[model samples]
Target chain A: MTRRSRIVGAGLLLLLVAVLSACGAQPVAQNWPGLTVGGGRVYVISGLPQQVYILDAETGVQQATFVPSGGEAGLPYWSPVTLGGDLAFVGFAESQSGTAGLYAFDPETGQERWNVPANDLILPAPTYADGTVYFGGSDGQVYAVDVESQRIKEGWPFQAEEAVWASPLVAGGQVYVASMDHNVYALDADTGQELWRTEVGGAMAAKPVMAATGEVLYVGAFDGRLYALRADSGEQVEGFDFKADNWIWSEVLLANDLIFVTSLDGRLYALNPSDGSVVSPYPYDSAEVADASDGLRASPVLAGETIIVTSGSGRVIAVKDAQRQWYWPSGLPQSSVYTTPVVSNGWVYVLLMDGQVQVLDSEDGGLQWSFSPPESQ
Target chain B: MGITDIWTVLILRPMLNALLGLYTVLGGQFWLAIIFFTVVVRLIMTPLMLPQQRSAKKMQELQPQLKELQKKYAKDREKLAQEQMKLYKEAGASPMGGCLPMLVQFPIWIGLYQSIIQALGHQPLQLLNLSQNIYPFMESISAQIPLNRFFLGMDLSLTPQQLGGLTYALPILVAFTSWLQTKMTTVGGSGGEGQAASMNQSMTLMMPLMMGFFSLSFSTGLSFYFIISNIIGIITQGFISGWEGLMFWKGMSLSSLLSGGGAKGAAAQKTSSTSSQAAAAGSGKGSQSGSKKRKKKRRRKR
Candidate 1:
């Protein structure tokens, strides 16, 4: 070929490459901020830039930040900053780079203590229990990592039939794992042996919550129903099935003798633990009140007799005795809320999908401080 | 509404729902649903592509005359262009005809890519966003909340780079099928000794490799879509035209194809022209001389 022809061919090749690249530009994964509060510090992973921000719990000011060293690009820290033992743990979701990792950091200084790559997406916060941190992996395994050794315990990563997006519930020598395979598994906490598995009507994404008595476990399903399973046998408790209109993705909060559950259909149900009966005139539908009609996603957090409900529509409501105490913003919000609000010392901290952290007075829902990460700004 | 809104309403929304519907029908087998979707899309697009394919075939037949015109007007570049246009006009062929089908396909590929990614819903945000796109009429969509993401021991929502090792086979198969389609539809290196041929030669080498690279970065489900779409393209072209060009082994080997040899294209064209001549003779049709006279008359009229 002549030089001119070669040049033209190369130019055309470049153009085609540009066009194809633009055509197949893949969408990157995004998530709401995963926030946890402990030791008077707020640990938040905003999922953008893959850094953990530690804030003063009282004032909501940035204290310290942790960024993984030599980190792979496009990996979102999806797991909430889990404070276990002396270290705070966070997990990076698997990316095209194939490196999903769990890292332990100094809760005070935000210094990395250790990191272990799981090679699969870690979606749920690691649950700390008795020197071992237990978390669910998208690879369908519940990993039990010893905090001291900073490694997965031998023969302890129990595999499920599907991805385990919910945190493993550990109570009384047993680990309860809810999987997308539509089954809740009870595994021996020490040896990782399966004790009993109960298949539910639909896939599960919410963490299983145990009753105050510790004998019954209540879990929500994508089938829009809450199933109460006997803790020891994985058998359904009779007369305790509460159905909703949409998927139940939030872990049911157990407080005030009421089992509080949020469904994607924007309704919040407070059921009696005995027979799954709705607290009369309860099951607050956000749509009936105002424009907060968008479905609820973030789990409700209890704050001194006030239940803080963060709606997917972005409004936050303080409910007490099945009546709304006060709702924030009173109008349109800049973005929706997906992260469950964390309450500490009478202050409610909500992480919006737009990366703003709104702090409010738990009693009257008054705006205290709104912090937007500098990186997001 | 905005352009993004228009795109979502007109293209993205329908494709997303159609894919979900297919996944439900295919028993939650995500990869199988992708293959079936590819076949259905190709079938729907075949009618729009038929005229372009026929025009491309005619242009391929006129390549020899176009090459002669290049030699006849070797120095007068302007005259060469005029003569080539005249010849194309006389033969009722368009050099730009093949481009229309490709132009039409670009948006579909883009929409399909977005649809596949959204359907896979690898993250919570993706799944939450999926609910918004689902039509209320698709009442079964909520029941199929999380479509199965696994196929053949691999996560369909993950890329080969994420899976690593043997999972790279998806991109390789994508390139292979793309090359097969190129071989079936392209005229090979026969229309030689020109800028267009040089570019065609370069394209025949680059297109498949580029597509393979794209699949490497895309989700494995999208890679499956590319492989299936290329395979469908090959079959569709073969049915629309004849299978002459696909007989790569007749006059060229693998090495020849890799090295940009003209033997494959020349051999394919030779087979095509010989068949036409034989049919003309069998029917007592006019010979090459008669055809030339008819072309001259047509050119004069034009």
Candidate 2:
């Protein structure tokens, strides 16, 4: 070969290598906060240069963005946005400024109302009840901040043995939270006093759910067991323990007499609310329904009697009366869905991992509209 | 399927399954599984590398003739190119022989890296992604979901920055091992004291530094892979070329950087003695035989 040709060949080879390397090392998207729909808007938190994206509920058009006050331009938002009254609360976990904490924003104007600083990461979405906002922090503390003042309530930060990743459930003047330290605590909502504590065998990541009767709370743990406890006394309910094949990362869903729970093992079990016995003959197996080998992470949402489910492999399906009704994308897996399906105004909003929102008809599961984040546009 | 889909099916999925299989067989010890995987991959690629080693040795031996041709055809670029090819054919050497093996391994390296990240599942989402890739038949591997990431007091899922303290040792070890491997395998006599030598020198320094920076920011699981891969590379080079090409102090010796030639002179003497020993030890090997036979032919021609 001529010297010139060899030089050209070498150059092309380097370019090919560079292109292949770039293609191979493409960054995997980080887990973003789940989507929330309320007050005519859809709220989403996107990763890498994280910002809160607000879209029109009906049109799926960009409305506004609320950027939290932090030293760095890009930081991940791990906790989902919680809307209460006119303000939406969200938390930033790892920040360059060391000022990682929660911020309250006006959903309409996309303006920050106030910011409360925390020492460690906050991975759980804040729970808003009455006039206070409660959230769990990586600092192993459950904190209550006044909704109006945006300051943590006096004597309000209750310490736990490990990071508090599960969102706090506030009901009947009591706050119920599950901690990674393998314990569940019932605390006084007024004074941050611990009322009762019960130890579950494994670390907890899913938020505890309260029964309609307000007497029992169900929490799932990494040990593959779901614990049903008396809400007031923190005592495990008799004959209510359910063992799953794998970790239960999704929150337990209570609908009427049946309780729906999804496990990392890819099966969705509908159980009797009182006895924890499997209610459905054929549990909604994600592996069978959506071909999702990873199972499900986003909690199942109920649209009327139709159960709307999203999988880690990106399939969105609606099951009604214990039968698979309709699914989105029709054929191939397009993207992963990490957020729970939000049902509002007869439309189910599904947030994909790539920061796109697909809105489908709740009754027939037909595609209604789709919205991509501003950056993608 | 698309290129990415093909890659996932053909490369990434198989490697991921292998990693999970190793993790399961190693009694759920992820770090040990990574080290074992590195060794296995190196072993698989070892045979493909023999031709490259042989080509490198031949090129090095043909350096004197190549230089003479260059000098004779200094102004005639076309003549120089033609003569170089003729000389290469006569010697049965390919200029691209050393690069072909690397090109073949590049895809495997990429696949291995993706497998490590996906299998480690540093984030919950990654774990979910891993679930989708796993084969249903691999029940033992699937049962070990959420593999324990804590290895020797360090969370393999966390970056050095996140772990803090002596966790910084991972990046340092990565850099040191990479530098040692690069120094050992870098062919010396082929490009004696010119742009090629300087480029090799810069690469020996830059690659390790770049990899160290990556280790500092990436998850410790990846850093572990890099460190293990480098250590394996050093061993592989030692077996292939021996220590003749290995140099601890090349550009600026400790004494040259600091006081004077006392340390530099001592280091030079030690390096020379070691090189001679390694050369003598490695002389009877496959590639070494090729160079030796060429030298005999050249001596007969003279």
Candidate 3:
């Protein structure tokens, strides 16, 4: 009788929740605020609307959205940057040449400061750490603009076999950049000299995350392999093939002793940080495909023990790190969420590529709030 | 460079011929052409698939004996393998029987999809041979279905074709069409349980839907292919499951005749089952007593 009551209660709760979700069912959302996570501020780059959305990081309430002041025409969605404090940087893309630059915005007020256009088109978000703002461009140069002067400082454009798409990573006075050349280059943070380079199969779209020890760098690749290289010398530390049946576009997330990653094959992988092994509890198999984006394209965010990952297929799954059990999915998206989810406190902030940034509670994966573009301008 | 090459001769030509036959018979209705094409494909595939189905039925009959043999040789894998071979021989069932139907069906599906794309000819050049003038209504229907709505609305060329294309409307279209296609083809068997299977089914439906939705920004031809192929597939599956061509006519007839009656019967059965468990069960008193004891224990525990 108790079992029956429990089942009934669960069924009722599920039915009620389903009904509510159905009422507020969003169209296939393309929320891809790519990998936005910082102190207390949650940021999402609304790629199509051509604006940056700032919301209460934990509560998912709309704080503000900043658009280019002088009637900005194009959307700057290719990349966005967080400066740890309240400052956020966004990059605009254009065909060949236009008003493509980087704007630093205040997360609280949605106000924009001076616009810093690179010598070339800003391809991705710049990295802001250690008194320097670092980003690369299609011009094949890694621009290190002084944070204070807001001008291009002594820059070192490492020439790759092809173009540069990934953002630079800073660790121990060095900036690590992965290139389409299938090489991970360790550069001098001060001078921008190529320190060392290691060839990885396929291009690396994901930025490398420095192991808490600042030795091994973990990043996923288009070759369907997760590579771990020595952050210092660019030597292969360890590696594992995702064999995703497709490419691995989702970046690797290191939380606790495990790494969370996804594939374009519609799978979320939890791997071992030490050896790049995905064991039983920490399955090599994907968690829940956020969407049918081919594989898991969204980056996974770690909120304490729970790892939240979204997919191009439009599913945001909460994976408990220790047990490796899926808590619940926020909901399937009508489309894919190309960007990663930002988890802070108890909330997971998702930047829907379809134009809405949704906030889901981390505990039960319940929808808390959603900030969509104001429809009529 | 043109997308079609000599490989077109092997797969596309045959399918196009089939499509041409259906289109000719149906008087150029896009929907009817799809139905005819699907029927022709399944009929052609049926001969190749017969051997496989028989083998599977044989396997099912052999499963019980195989399990018995497994139990008898629980301690010996070598002996178990030898005995299993004997059991298989006695049953006259090849172990690989199940994969045959799928093996025959998979290619037809792929070929059909490819043929649809080729027929729609999203590329202006490929459009050269497609017979768009076969029907007066065709030009408008062709415009309604997009070419790049690849699978669901997916631009086969783009990653998250909808998202990558930066076109949001496409995914929604994909989902709707995919749901329609799935409902048309889903197995009607009662045991539709298991969370994983449901998840898998949804994903399968979603992938095409995502592709279709993304196809909005792409060439309309791709979406047209998806719509036509799915409509065709559902028709084909229905024909295959429903005793060949007869089921479709019967289903159409029955839907008109039985929809209301069916609903009432289901509801009435539900109400009667609640009021009369004995009648619903229709078993002896011994089984009733056993069930009652269990129910009483459950009540007491509560």
Displacement of residue A243 (Cα, Å) in model 2 is: 5.9
By lDDT, rank the candidates, best first. 1, 2, 3
Between which residue pairs do clashes occur in model 1? Answer: none
Instruction: Give candidate 3's error at residue B219 in angstroms.
Output: 13
lDDT of 3 by residue, A1-377 (tens): 11233344345435534432342212321224444757566666654555666666666676777776553543333466566445777666543235656677776777887667754555456888866778876555677766677776665555655445678898889989886557788888888888998987766656888878877888776556778888777788744434434555556777667677776555666776767667566543343343232345667777766777665546666677434445334344454466667676677777665657777778777778776666412
Best by DockQ: 1
The segments of candidate 3 whose C-alpha lies over 4 angstroms from its true place after superposition are: A1-31, A34-40, A58-61, A69-71, A74-77, A84-86, A119-123, A238-244, A284-293, A321-332, A375-377, B1-302
lDDT tens digits, residue span B65-172, model 1: 555567779999888877877866767776666566666676677787778777787667777667557776774666665688788789887779878988899889
* TM-score of each predicted structure versus truth: 0.83, 0.78, 0.50
Q: What is the alpha-carbon lDDT for the whole of candidate 2? A: 0.74
Q: What does the lDDT read for residue A230 in candidate 2?
A: 94
Scored by Cα lDDT, where does model 1 land? Answer: 0.77
Ranking by DockQ: 1, 2, 3
Best by TM-score: 1
lDDT of 3 at A259: 75
Model 1 lDDT, residue A112, Cα = 86
lDDT digits (tens) for residues B29-109 of candidate 3: 544566556555656666655554455344433433444455568788688778867656655766544345544544454
The docking category that best describes candidate 1 is: acceptable
| Model 1: per-residue Cα lDDT over A1-377, one tens digit each | 23453565466557667866775545444666788989999887763756788888888888898877555575455688888778898887545456677888899888988887785888888888999989888879888888888888887789898888888899999999999888999998889999999998887888899998989999998777899999999999998868877778899999988899987878889999988888976878777554433678889889999788888778898887778989987777778888899998889988888678888999998888877887669
